[model samples]
Target chain A: MATRGDSAGMNGGGGVLLLLRKDWSIFTLRHRIFVLTVFLMAALQAVVVDEAYFLLGVALAAALAVYVPVIEWYQGTDPMLHSLPVKRGTVVAARHVVTILGMATAGIVWNTTGRILRPILGGGGSDPAFWMTLEGGLTYSLAVAILALLFFPLYFRFGMGRGIAAFAVMTLVLLAVGYGTAQLAAGPAAPGAVGLITPSSVIGSRVDTLLASVGPAATVTVTLAGMAGAFGISIGLSRRWFATREF
Target chain B: MDAVLELRNVCKTYEGFDLRDVSFALPHGYIMGLIGPNGAGKTTLIKMILNLVRPDSGDIRVFGLDAAEQGASVRARIGFVHEQPTFYEGLPAHRVATTVGPFYPAWDEAEFTALAREFGLPLRRKLKTYSHGMRTRFSLAMALAHGAELLLLDEPSSGLDPVFRRDILGRLSAIIAGGNTSVLFSSHLTSDLDRVADYITFLRDGRLEFTLTKDEVLERYALVKGDMSLLTAENRRLFAGIVTGEFGFVALTTNVEQARTALEGQAIVVDRATLEDVVYFTGRTGEGGLRLNGNTR
Candidate 1:
């Protein structure tokens, strides 16, 4: 029963919340199915691989987050969106907030379930299990934030079709570099000692060591800074792109 | 009187068509009917007013504010209904209203709910499930709910049944009776406009043919019916556009008095022209041997 006047005088935070409500309502049956499938897959993987599966689930969820904004952009609903009194930049920014929130929610559920099941499955002790789950969740959130920051601006500037092509090209170039790095790391002269040179192993060792060395506060600070920096850059680019757009 | 809306020398060019130097004004509290055939730039003109498409030149002032410079403020005061109703298909009518209504400062939920009930819109059902008529009604409810002073409708009656069209016109008339509200409806259906429009603006091939009050239009042109043999060279030239038949001759003339005077002895009958006849005659193509000067009647 909220009236129009009630929604007036909304600052950025209030606008983002209103936008989130609208986006949630607009998401259809197909979207629910897609989200459910991702969650189910992640749940099954968690049951099999314990804590590592939770991080994989977050990565997968973050990758899928791109679909929400991309679909909206391609639908060419700007005329309808612009018809409202909301500013164009606010509309663009709100989509990013909604996508990130959705991704975070999925990550929380995945990590929560993994935590509950770790003790029941008798995979590891509670201390290492707790720290591993926390580290995995943070890393997954950070990776997705980086991808969204790099890709969403491109999607906003160019339409979905071209944006997807650009994303694919960028992804392929990164993959090729990753492949070259793997070859150099696996060379005969290199140390093949267990838990030494692999990117995943190195990241896992550093994250656990960091969690142990500094308190959770330090780890959280670094993660918050990285997420904030990514969000800031993406928002800046999105605002610039939207201001010059004809619609 | 202060003009509610004014378009000065507006022009837009597409790949194959061009809207050139189109200009008109609607006084406050008057319903202006934009009458034209298909592809006559009616939608284009409305879009320009809405700032959905920027004009190549000229200025548009809405509610005494420049449209381009103050697009959001101008749009805030205007309500719009497109020919094809588009809404969030996933949301119910009530949710749709909840989502869209908050963006408008003047939106009235009570009014919207009342109108939705009056229009028999199913507030609980998703819009994609609504029939075409129901969707149009929902769109109308949304437009009216915002307490918008100026309503701009583009071909709103195109797909509607006559009964629904009449209901819409009746509701519009009641809305205009409030005295603070005005409407500019573009439609090919002349009968719909005849029922509610106070003024008429005719566009043909993207050019402004004329903009006149409904009474002035009726007075300015006369439909003449007479024998073909009685049609003289000078009188025929006076009739800007004419249709001849075996029974009699029918012609549209701006100076009804002059045509009547010149063809006094030869004429059979002369009657007042309707809005449809005025549009048809004025929209006729080049050089039909009818030279129109100033006011005809």
Candidate 2:
């Protein structure tokens, strides 16, 4: 029944960009009211509390990444997406793109706002030394990326509630691993180490020598490349799992 | 004839229900009513065409391209209204349209605007607030606004009132009258099919009974009524199905001409069958020679 010579009907004009924009639009839809309320709470926490300001923003960013794919799903539009011209792979790709961009945006916006507003609201610059550290930014990015990278495959595999449940279990495992890694990074907490993390700056020269040999730019490149590799693997798994799933 | 869509030996099996080698084609610029009772796999067939549900073994060609492999291209040319139409519910009707419009290359804002006005859709009203009929109208408007080659609708008119149902039927007739679009409308309501369908595809218990021109169905099939004395052994074989009541006996014959010639001068009357008669009779007859599949002659 391969009539019409096989190539007759492939004029697919829409791409992942179309789906990406649609996902972004959901934030402004019904969920925006709730999202704004949460943001105010996070901001108040940042201004009033001495700690958890920047982490609150990163946590919210990760929360959004988990929330977007499930938004239309709850609206009963998930099956509707399969009817659209976009490929399944394309849909998964746009979601991954949204997750990555969403994390970056939420993280940077929080960092910038915290820097400007924390001093104004408190009338003091009790900036923790770690907040002054770019290393803290690296840690924030890792947290954001790790949460998203881990959640998507589970989300694509198990749907929202189950996916989050699976993510919660994995989060516990990751927290344990992160605690172990933090212990290894700690030499001794440096002066004004922000009470959040044991200062990696005080770690002796063996780590510095390794970075020196690798070169700072090369070290940065390897970290980013590692993140990219993790994203690639997660995308592949999501695509494979979603392909056979019928609505 | 260049078919806009075709399915050949399409078989999908699930626990407790299956589409038993169903196959048919919609030639360019005609409406095919996929008529079936509940659980008859009409919706399943429509979903298979959309590639939302993959068939176990079959080939689906749309505009001559393999539907499973070239789904994006094939789906791009199709405008679908699901059994339960879904859109971004939180937004106003207009924004929902805007959000989906980009996916369709031929989407016309002006055409959508006109359709919204014609359907009395309050474009600024949030879609969640609209009634089911309004949502169906919006789905239809969206389906038509895109220059789709094929429209696959599943029970699209069930939610509308009789007045709007007639209005929507007229619109479908007009849409296909342009001679570029074909529709495969799946609905259990045969009266709607009788109104506008050029062809009728009957399904029962996940089996395709027949796909024939509406004219052929009306002309060939007939209803026969007579006294119980007319129920001779030879004459009983003439009827595809028979029902006995207190007053008399009524029967359905697939070939009214044969039944007419066979029963001449007897106390029996044979009249052309309505689409409803055909479905009810054949369904009563159960699974036998009713599977005409699609007429070749």
Best by DockQ: 1
Would you list the C-alpha lDDT of every candidate in the order shown? 0.74, 0.76
Candidate 2 C-alpha lDDT tens digits along A1-247: 1112111211212366666677767677457668757876677666544336646766768767766667776877876878877687877787778878877777776666666766667723355523434555555555565556788888887777778899899877866675656655653564333233321332212234445687667655665765687788888988887777677
Chain B TM-scores across candidates? 0.91, 0.92
Q: After superposition, which runs of candidate 1 have C-alpha atoms over 4 Å from their true positions?
A: A1-14, A28-34, A42-78, A113-139, A154-223, A244-247, B221-271, B278-283, B286-297
Q: Residue B100 CA error for candidate 2 (Å)? A: 0.7
| Regions of model 2 farther than 4 Å from truth | A1-14, A43-55, A116-132, A165-216, B227-244, B257-266, B285-297
lDDT of 1 at B159: 72
lDDT of 1 by residue, B1-297 (tens): 679999999998888899999999999998999998788899889888877777999899999898866776787788888776777776778998888777777788899999999888889998779987787788888889888899998888877788888989998999899998999999888888888999999998899988999888778888877776766676677776766545556678889888878877764688888777776666442245333443233
Docking class of 1: acceptable
lDDT of 1 by residue, A80-187 (tens): 666665655666778677667767776766666666766666554445553356675566666667677877777777757777798789877876675667666778
Model 1 residue B243 lDDT score: 66
